[model samples]
Target: MKKKLYLLGVFILCVVTLSGCIPTSEKKSDTLGLESTDRYELLIGLNDVGTGKQIMDTQEAIEIIKMKLLRHVSGVTITVSNGYYYVGAFIVDEATLNCVIYGADDESIAAVVNEINSDMNVSVLVSKTPSKYRLITP
Candidate 1:
């Protein structure tokens, strides 16, 4: 019986694997297209978790900001603050992106932040001490 069950499981696995081989629609440009082209591109806000205010300008704060932005932009695993990173329903601008950062090295974060900030409408807040930021529509 054990042998039979094992064979059944293997058969099921094979079926499942082979099912994925089925051909799918190759043309889905509309679904994968970028949907952003309007005014009020994006808004970035900073929040100081320690002071309970919106402020980002420290070593620790920068780390958190990068972590959050990377997740949203690159679809990587990341932790975000509550009520933060809210993407609104508006067409984003594809030029001169507006991003939010927290650190003395603003240029460094700008590179990465801008990557996610492009053609997107939202607000972001980055802070230190349990640092984090909130991205929302403005």
Candidate 2:
């Protein structure tokens, strides 16, 4: 009886100790080519309509846009200089009709794009690794 009890305890101990050593499959991230530490870079193109005229170049406009975008971007920060807006060290260039947004994960990126793209003027290509950016207005 004593020997059986001792063996049972040893087996239990071994099982407990080895359970952590066993390998388990890890879940894939929603973002392609994205590690837990990796962040996304979004190249933003702001346009008013199909005419290709870039508007809303003002502090108020920037504030409004930032407010709109803040929900999707985690810990967003904005700055103004050189006729451009900066979002967490990323650039918002209305002059060139292009901009940059940084530090978004895959879900957040989708949300951000969806919020801005109401009239199908925006399309996203997320199937690629490392991501791609193309904003077309028509």
Candidate 3:
């Protein structure tokens, strides 16, 4: 009887531990805000106006661009990376925008690009391609 009770207690402890490891259905559903059907990539390039041109801080610019992009598409994932433009032996800093836009159409993408161009001082280049992978937030 004592051995059976000990085994039962251990079994109950194991079941509770395993249950905690399992994710709730609500959490799984909340993983992504966008629909999985259609997605696109938007790559924006930023450059200075001229040799002596001044621009906003790199991080500030990235955040500003991200906020503007989010306004157009709420579920999009925006990632920013640093890039360099080589002018002869000189290297210049450039801000690169990598956005995974969910459920985006050509018209919506074009509109976002136009908005970015008008709001930012940096020259912008927009590229759109169907996304092959889903954007996951960490």
Candidate 4:
């Protein structure tokens, strides 16, 4: 009886110890050239809609755009300089800059864009790049 009880305790201890080694999430392989689908870069440029110059201040426009973007993406990096905007975000497949900047059917994205457009008369140029392509930041 003593020998059976001792063996049972040892088995339970081993099972508990090994269970901790299991991973909770899928691990990425170290294979070279593995592409990441979740990375993207967004560039936005503000320019005069017509022959006249842009009336809104460049810095203020940048801040307004930044705040709107933050509402959709959590860990986005946004910077603006000389009427140009740069945004870097991960896991941003659904919430795209073009969708947010240009009015889209998506309610969340459209709301932000419409608000900005209504306040400013400047035209916007939006560009999106995949993760493989590197963007030149200012």
Candidate 5:
């Protein structure tokens, strides 16, 4: 009986010790490249939609657009300049997709022309402005 009990305890100790020694998985994911985010830095020139004259050259404008786009995400800071805008959006692993709108809260480009949307593209109205400028992601 003593031998059996001693063997059982040793087995239990080995199992416990070996379990802690196992290595954990360190896997990453790749879905949408846009979703992963980058040290993204792009410039959007503010030219008059009509005359093509430069209206504003500002990092502030870029910062505003960056903040508006990534307000709900984590680990992002946008810098704007007079000549162009700079963006570095870092999405946390927990972020989820949602339609985000900013500015006069209008779904129109008039509310936010000369601005860059999340697709990292410039947004301009072809005709009369819509109700608001919106960013939608899957």
Candidate 6:
């Protein structure tokens, strides 16, 4: 009886996984492809996180960046990385932070990334985030 129950559980797990019943934490692009236009993402580093020789307070950096980006652009989405970065969202933490900025046009994205990288404590890595892979999550 125990063996049969274990097999049932395994079968249920496979069904759920194959049927796409599992949920993922990463926010997704729009289902309608409204944000299908060209958008970019900026992977940001700061202080030691920025340049190898630089130094900074992580929280302070996040605040400064949030304010600066907020002023220049209203549509940008910024997520703080826990001293590391992934392609998309994850559970946040209190440790040193990195940043990802996405969902904007080429010119706007370039302008903001340049603005942030111009700061002595920050450096920016530019990459095209395909709208299909990650755009405005619905």
* Per-residue error (Å), model 2, residue 136: 38
What does the lDDT come to for candidate 5? 0.41
RMSD to the true structure for each prediction, in A, is 16.8, 13.8, 10.3, 14.5, 15.3, 12.7
Residue-wise lDDT of candidate 6 within 9-120, one digit each (tens)?
A: 9999999888797666899656665644444555566645333533657667778777767666555556766444443565322243343444556677667677777764
Mind giving the per-residue lDDT tens digits that candidate 5 earns over 13-74?
99999999998787654342323212222334444434434444344445555565454333
Model 4: per-residue lDDT, tens digit, 94-119? 11123222222245444545655565
Give the worst 10-residue stretch by lDDT in candidate 3. 27-36
Which lDDT tens digits does candidate 3 get at residues 21-95? Answer: 998776455344644445667666666555324367667777887778777776666787866778789887666
**TM-score of every candidate relative to the true structure:** 0.21, 0.40, 0.54, 0.39, 0.27, 0.49
Q: How many Å off is the CA of 8 in candidate 6?
A: 53
Give a tens-digit lDDT track for model 2, residues 1-138: 999999999999999989989997897555544333433433344445364445555554556556666777754444443335565877744532123454467787677667766632432233213434333458
Q: What is the lDDT of candidate 4?
A: 0.50
Best by TM-score: 3
Off by over 4 Å in 4: 1-35, 38-40, 81-115, 132-138
Model 5: lDDT of residue 5 = 100
Ranking by lDDT: 3, 6, 2, 4, 1, 5
Which portions of model 6 show Cα errors greater than 4 Å? 1-33, 48-54, 82-103, 132-138
RMSD of 1: 16.8
- Using TM-score, rank the candidates from best to worst: 3, 6, 2, 4, 5, 1
Q: Which stretches of candidate 1 lie over 4 Å from their true place?
A: 1-77, 84-104, 128-138
Give the CA lDDT, 0 to 100, for residue 50 in model 3. Answer: 54
Top-scoring candidate (lDDT): 3
Error of 2 at 1 (Å): 65
